[model samples]
Target: MKLPYLPQDYSKKEHIIILSILLLFAFTAFLLTIISTTGSTSDYVPLTNIYLGTADITHINVTKVVPQIGPILAILGTALTAPNRTLDNIFDSLKTISETPALVPLMYLLSNAQNVSQSLISLTQLAPLAISGNPATDTKDLVEISGLLKVSSNESQTLNGLKNLVVPMLQSTNTSNKEDRTTELTLDLLADSKDPLTVAKSLTVLNNLTMEEKMKMIPIFTLFGVTKNITSLIGSLETIVSKGDAISPARSELMLTTLQTMLASNPNVTMAFGTISSLASGDDEKAAIGAIQTMLEDSNNVNTTLSSLSTLIKSNVTQAESSKTSLVALSSIIQNVNDQSKAVTTIAQLASNTDTATTTAQLSALTEMLKATEKGTETINILSQLQTSLNPNSTTFKYIPSLFTLLDASADPPVSFSSLVTLTAWAQQNPQTFIPIMGILSDALAVKMVSEDQLTEMTPTLLEYLRIPVYFQLSIFTLCKRNLEKDILECSASHAVQNLDFRQIIYDALSASEFAPYLNALNIGPNDLYLEGDLLNREHEYVPSIKAVLAMNILGIVFAFVVMINIGFLFWMKWSSKSYAWVIVIFLSSCTALFLGLSCTVLTVVLQVIKSGTYKDAFGVVFTTGVAYSAMMWCSFSLMVISSVVLLWVGITERHLRIPYLMKKNPATIEDLENSSTEADNAIQETKHEATPGQIIRHSTDNSSDFLKNDPDEKQDAVPDIQQTNTSDSS
Candidate 1:
């Protein structure tokens, strides 16, 4: 990677020299500024005056202040004379000069100097500082300027800073000279006050006051500054002492010592006393001080504790929104507890004594209830109070936490506050209904059997139904009972009925007595009723094997029917003529037997296994009829075998009995060959006179011989015979 290149400024040699000279001048001025800040009071102020354009050459000797004053005066004098001088403009030009720590004291000194007011007009232009300058500065100047500077030198820094703070405020406010006099008087009194730091802070507070507020405090400060009558003070103290209630001397002394010490440390407290006194009566001030003293003496960390609690409450807003009703009930329950501490101890015992698993479950239940109600604090308080009343080893106590957690989630206030209260008076009449009904509610809440909105909507109706002294839950259960008679396959087809979850609802209602008959009828027990798991997570519908078995049976019947048809056709087409037709018939018959037999076998095994077990709930009478069905299937198989054998025998018998008629027509047979032979005989008779040439010649020769033997004188006849023979031979 290439390095970044920096552009450099190139200066000519002459420019560099000029730059160096200018730098040298700046450095000299900076050194002079430092000297001017730290030197003697006269030396510092007069030198600052030069740069500030306030220097009067006639009054000050520059060389006396510093040997380099000539150069400084020369530069500053030229700059000062070049423009019309105004405090704002002069200050603007001098803004580049860095402020030094020593400037405060030098300015304080100049502001107090006599006859140099015009030169240092802005330094102490404030009424507060200007009025305090004479007497207050007299005391300081006597030590630092007129006499030894040691007496008040320790207090000078604080006093000077106070003066600096007041100057800007006094200058900024457009107040009349009368208001200025009053402000100056207030400052004069404050400067003379005991603690300078406290006085300075108080004076700052007073300096920031508006013209109206200053006018308000002037008369108060006037008495505070000039009130020096010992007799008057004695009378006022006497009046207070007489009017005030007496306390033990010990307490009085102790309180006085505490107040005195506090005054030294935080003199603002004394100002507070003065302010309160001015605003009210002395008695009121005493009462206010007592309150403050009591507050100081108290050690509770209420502020810190409340802050944390407030933060926790704010963080639980979302949770509270969901379970508003429950939280409200919990809060009331907590507040209404007679012995909160004892209850809390009992609840604690309940948790500690329970099994770890049970405890975890209870805690989870509590947490959910808290989320639902947004009443965590109230639930916690109730649980804490209930702790002392709970028996660790008691079974009832084991569910107490879970029960309370559930109750905390109740939506209806009437029911929540008094959980045992029913929707109707009938529950009061029959305690049994009440018992089961209450159990139902508890279970419903504990297991989340219903949603909050649902519980809210149905609480009254369900409560009434429960108290009606009837089997209300059976109504719901009957909706699911339609599947009781169905086999696994049938049940799966009708599985949508399970969506009602009547079983779970009955379980939640704690009224399973009504549903017991259905349970037994279906051959399912209470343990099979799922109370915890999700219904959707279960396979409530189809059994793949049962469906496959049903398909197989259907396919077998169809195949058997097709094979029987084919066999019948074969027997009909070639039964008597084709010998091998029996073979095809047997093959087809065997195939039909196999299909039927296999289907029956599968059905028998499956039905038997299902019937032998507790599958009545799933398969009902469908599988339970295995014995009868098996027998029927076996009979079917036998029938199929018998039919196939009969077909085979028929084919074989027909082939053997069938014979071709030869010599004479067999009356038993109706064949085309016999009819063809009869027709051939008739043809022979019709063509008997139609002889061939050889037969005709031979017949003529025989006839001619007989004529010659029978009549010798017939030589012409003989010749005719010969000539006929010759003509026949030629033809």
Candidate 2:
């Protein structure tokens, strides 16, 4: 009955304790399952509720089936814990097991579950400051807003003074003229200004215009117009302000006179002479003429000369005798300059062709002369004298109108001068006087200075700028984008400027700022959320939204599968009988499974608690969730504790204090048993020969009792053992 080498503690007591614990765990888990199934219709416990074609089999429940899962697993795991195989070997086998058809699918399930949980957390956290509660709605609004800004930015610059003013002027409503509405809105924005009340006074002059006055307003507001005497002029003074120019009293007076003179002289001007005449007094007209004369006489009047040439070019020369006469005189002067080297040709090419290359070269020459001359006034005087020379009758004029009949043959400007090479050569050789004069003339046109009329026209255009909503919304989008790009508080900076309140940009324009007057005039207010701020605030919902609930469910299933895999692996190891450290592996593995399963299940219930907010419902959910968690935890814990105790019993009971069946040789074979029987027989014979019959009987009974104690199944063979024990030798 005795084995050659058995683990000391391998016994019925040890097996009984382990099996008892597994039975208790299985029973408790089954009880919980029943309670959960019957308690509430809404409650859906994961492992217990797995439905497969309505078999309704209780044994199929993985959690309750301890004999197949936990005990078998522990046994296999215990056998696997030999001194040869290690935990690392177990882990390697686990990785290999992951390739199994059943387990591989669980990996993806677990991964997806984790993603759902994390994504729900992010959404709830970001929902607070988002433009709308619905993410799709907010995203649509953002796209629309982006489109609006794109169009506004492109179109905002194209609106000139005249175009900006004309639309509002023609827009008449039942309540007020659209122009007046625009002005009123602008006025309200300026209502809280710390400065003097100039806004109302300025708008009053515009609002007082009659129908005829409004008609007159049209022609005088063009930006650049070609004329008879004045070649090019800005139609309005308002452009000066819009372009951010400084306008002193002297500059203002000079602008006003210059505008009047230019308008009166421009034969191609659309405005009537009488209207142009009416805009300036007789004295103002004379002063303007004097200012033009003085500016010309000072030798810095290339501006005036170019203006005259542009006007002559634009004139109705084909129809008007006066324009033809001026052109004739201009041609004669150009011919006179040609006598002074090929410089005149460069000048002619610059003026007629308006070639950028020729113009740039000429301008560069003038810039050099100005730099060399150092005294800007002296350079201006020199250029002004050159300009005067263009006027054939001036005392400062160098070229006089000649009596050459051949010159009049080409009344119109020349079409072509020289080739690209020759023109460049001409510009290079004639760098001194001719090039500088041409340069000065070209420089004069580049700045595009506005006239007083243009300056006055900008008032209405600016008012329109204030009324447009995209103007501010675009600014907010830009600010937020910047803040996002930089990851900083760029939006918090104040941007107010120049009686305009140009700064302090935000997401929703109507709701923010001191520009409430404009909002009121347009009938938008704090209640109107037309402009939405699409920022995500820090606050999140206590419970993740409905989306989160779905995520939790997915994760729970994943956790359940994970726990099952570990239990399955444990059973495989136990069945293999290769492991000596099964007790520790079972204990640790069960704890890990318990932790994963219980944590995820409890988290699902926690999410529900966050949603309902009612303590009554919360308590019920919490209780159910707790019970489920406890059952799983207890199942794993009991498996681990009982499995470890059984292994320890084996360790304590074994004589060799090592695993049973580890040694290669077996000492309990037939040949070894026969030899042991012969030795027993000889020892018995010696005892019979030396001892009395009573001692022999006593000794034989003692030997039989010892043998029976060792082998419980051999109790029936005890009488035969005494009868065959050499009684004749003892007698």
Candidate 3:
């Protein structure tokens, strides 16, 4: 239906009131937009600056004055907008004030600035302005104003100020009017502010009110959309509870009670189960957990809580991943309850679900709960129950096999590790039950290796496969040493032999030739092996000698030493210069051949050892080709070959000696020698002419300065002196 319109034959006073209400509404809408968009009232300063044509303004304290104006305008608008002079229409108009979104920020502004006292006084004085001379309409307006005063009476100052204004107003009203006033105040408080502290304080006040008053407020809570957005209500309660020591125990209890009442009153509020679970499990807040526990213990609420949790755990994978922490917390809480059979059954169903998405979180939460629970008959009983729940079709079955299936299917390392840890702990408690699971473990390992090509990519998988046997063997040995009365070695060895057979599983799995490349990628050595002959009861046949390995290492060290000594000797004798490039080339080439031979021998020994089944079946023996040693040998060989080629090039060019037909030229004749001598003379003359004073000075400083002699034209003197000496010898 369309809203009632203003009468056309209106008085000037009525017209003024209508215009004022419209203007107030437009202004309130604009302010709400600004606060909602920017999330702060400080944004108002920009508009203020724009209107005033000033930019220097830093802050405008609208907190005190604006809140007072909103309620006054609301009362005035409601009182004037009533179609008839009746209490019902005026009350109806007043209810619309609670629906106004702008009142939330306005109420929050007053609450934050601690200006509730002043705002209440202003609203109280303006309450009379809403009187339209009708006794009933005036009485309803006074009751509303009284409710506002009561809701705002949270602080001592505000409460004291409310007494003078509220007592006289309430005395004039009857019981129903008092209830109506309480309802008005409750709605005004609950519906107007979304601030956690304000909501929490409102709940506190509601809790202190009489039972009738609280019951009256419940429907208002639902009608005003408070229960529809129950997550926010729960969130506000969590904010109060999270304050820890800052909040009193009484206040916390009131908050929890308020929550319980909301949950009980509205079944629709249960849709916030995810949020409730998160709050219960997200923090170790006693109040939150207590409230949840109370709900679970109640016969009426238990099913709802359990069903919500189960649905969350069984939700799609994305929800499951995000709910991991919540599930873990729920599991922990369930443990403390008297009968957790249903909860345990729910978690087991999640764990057994074929959907891999939810299994990761389910298994993690279940395993962590199992680990945290103390081991005893209680633990055994829980496991037994879980086994039946997990494998409902089988009569005489163990959960270990189901766990293996889940473990194999899961690619997450944490899930896999947790499963293994649970198994290990269970084995420690019940060794007999663990005995049958050993074969299951072996089968699982084999399946894992076959299905997963990059097992090494998972550190847990690699460690479980390669290192678990050694760790287990050592653990057994330690246990034997501690418990056995005599013959510790014999006792340990006897028991260890039985356990060491599991190593055969690993050996058999890795024996496939296709695994060689993967194994070689890992630095597996003799230490990682369990030699065949070293078994306690086996006959010694092949000892797997390392003499070849030793010989190769010795030869490599000797060659390296020889090369170093030869190079040092050449340098000391001054024979490694350009004239002796051939000598260096020979030395480097010989070293290269020796390194290459050593590298080949090492590789041959390693490959032969691997092929001989010694590397695979060797028990309690360390055998490796020494990956670092082999790499070093190859690198040394490469360096020597490179050096040889470089030195050969230097020797060929520096000495200017050509081999065979590559250099076919005659020796220098006398005329050719003379021409070279004349060219040298001309070069010297050019150098003398072009020399700077500094160049001459540097040349003169040298001890050998024959080229810079005082006589520039004294050329061919050495040649003439040589000719005279030859003539004298002939005479």
Candidate 4:
């Protein structure tokens, strides 16, 4: 049979060589089997004793059947040169491949590879499954686990196949979906490795407090908290490891939580308390706070640790009137040593909200620390948290109190105004559910030159966030969100400053110096209706007494308004310029309008741009926003077109719109005329003096008149006016 493609070089020589090799392999393999059956030789077997499920009788039968079908091996060579050999014998050849004892290891290798391929599909089904409400659901996806155990083949397959399957699964789970794919992969590996570390990591993941893991952990941890189930899991884990104190990494974390829980619920024995107190008592603050600091630093632990710290601090200390606060001063070493934002937030909330006497004292210590201390790790963390702590529903509502306190002009010996500036910006962004920050409101009304000058540290040109003029909301540009200090500044003023950084911005900026701290936290930006709240607050106001917005929520709303205006302005500019780059402008306008909703006048401009197509006409569209971003886009288009037209009329058209076909069709230059030289020559001859049948002219008046028309008027009489004659023969 002829084939579509054939190998050129292959010939009978190659076939003979292959046959010789195959015969040699088969003959040697047969000889080895004979010897192994005959004598008790130590080197009889190349592969380990990983025999398949069939007994030795089946192996003998497979061997007999292979020779009966041995002729099929001929097709393993080039099919064209050996056309008589065909895949019709593919089944028989497969039987030979199966029976070849020398190829046992390779056959095992491929079979294991095939299992890996099957695992790929199993993992596909497992991906979404792993993210199920509990780890159990993801864990039950046993297809991959079954593949890993390999009841069919054991010695040849390494743990490599199972080990790597979890990494991607772990990474894929990291999103709004809150999927914990890692836990599923880890659970599958338990059957293969049987290593305590593997089981421990899986257990710890199951017990994690994330929304995904919480359902699993909540039952376990709560059970641990209330009953003895956690103890059972712990005891089972201890028995598996057979080690008393050196538990696996996963189990250690669970144990820590268990310890914390036990401490809260059941007071520890005197000896145990003494041991912990000793650990906490180190004069070396680094050593004293390392463990607690690490836990507090994690975004996962921030809320938990903050609540714990607040409870701890309140229980241990009391404020006195006419006393200088010692909180920041006492904790400066701790704060300066750690870079945990949650810890910083925990400290800041407590430190900033102290009564009048303590506020002054604590404020001084914190201010001095921020100024002189090179360790801004804590400040960045705290600032980042304070930036996000603007949850309208928070019980303490730290943003309003801290900001208003900073804005309080009447407080004796004002604290560091610069540090508070950034903090105030954050509070403005996240308005509390209750209480208006009147102090910050008044400060907006009384903006001084010095305060504006202070904005030089962060790029004020980009952030110029407060331009929105909201009492609570602080307006900032997208550029200022480059760093923690600036981000906090931006986050603080979010109530007043409407533009929220998209996740893409954070994803891109994660590598940048400023916003790197935010990669691990959940700092969601609010947009239009921005609060789909039960109408938490409807009015916005700035209080002169405190120099801040009375209702920080209103400030956030105003910030959103200004953001709408900025978006509208940008779109309008792009539309007016008649730039093809309007695609990007379109995107910016969309995001802004979407954020602004139909409540801003910017939407009117945007809509007019879309409808009128003339940028000049967008001004008419400038109506109060009513949640219509599409309208805003049209308005922007109108403004852009109108502006472009005005610029053209004023002779400022650098980017001019030339008539499309006119340039292509019109002969504007001598080169163009020369291109139509035949037409030019024919026309020239036709206009010459007419030599009628009876008369001929040697000189032509038509040529002379045409030349005179083009000649200078001063030289018009240089040539005499010639009379036309058609007497060619006489001439």
lDDT of each: 0.31, 0.30, 0.32, 0.27
TM-score of 3: 0.21
lDDT of 1 by residue, 1-731 (tens): 11011011212343234324433332332233233222222222232122100101112222222112222222223233333533234334323111322222222222222222121222212212212324332122111211111122322322222223233323423343322222233223322333323332332332333444333323222221232332232233233233234333343344445555555566555454454345433563465344333332231332332232223223332123322332232223223344333322332233223123322333333333333333233333333333323333422233222222322332222222121211112223433323432322222223312322333343233223222111211110021111112211111112211133323433433333332322232234434543332221232421343444345444445545555445444433224234455566567556655655775565455435433432323211122232323444455555556656766655443312222111013322222323433554555556666866566321112212332344243222000122233234345
Per-residue alpha-carbon lDDT of model 3 for 355-403, expressed as tens digits? Answer: 2322233223223332333332232233233322322243212222332
Error of 4 at 707 (Å): 99
- True-structure lDDT of candidate 2: 0.30
lDDT of 4 at 674: 30
Score candidate 1 by lDDT. Answer: 0.31
lDDT tens readout by residue for model 4, 1-731: 11101122223354344324433332332233232222211212221111111001101111112221111111121121232433334223333333333123222221222222232222222223222333332222232233323322331121222222222322333332653322222222222222323222323322222333222222212212222222233232223222322333343344345446545665433433344445432333223233333333332433354344333223221121111122222123222223223322233233222132322332232233333323333332332233233233432232233222222321211122222322223323332310122222222223321221232222222112212111111121112221212112222211322222222222333223232222121122222102111111211211121122112222323333343343344333223223333233334333333322322233233323323321122211111222222232234333333333332332222211121112234324223323343444455467564556766433223422332233223111111111111122124
Task: Please tell me which model should have the higher TM-score, number 1 or number 2.
Answer: 1
Overall local distance difference test of candidate 3: 0.32
lDDT of 3 at 404: 26
Candidate 1 segments exceeding 4 Å error: 1-419, 423-574, 608-625, 642-731
Better of 2 and 4 by lDDT: 2
Please report how far candidate 2 places residue 480 from its true position, in Å: 45
Better of 2 and 4 by TM-score: 2
Candidate 4 stretches greater than 4 Å from native:
1-106, 110-731
Candidate 1 vs 4: which has more TM-score? 1
Least well predicted 10-residue stretch by lDDT in candidate 3: 51-60
Candidate 3 residue spans exceeding 4 A from truth: 1-549, 565-574, 577-581, 611-627, 656-682, 693-731
Error of 3 at 100 (Å): 83
lDDT of 2 by residue, 136-193 (tens): 4323322222232233322222112112222222222223522222322322222222
TM-score of every prediction relative to native: 0.25, 0.21, 0.21, 0.14
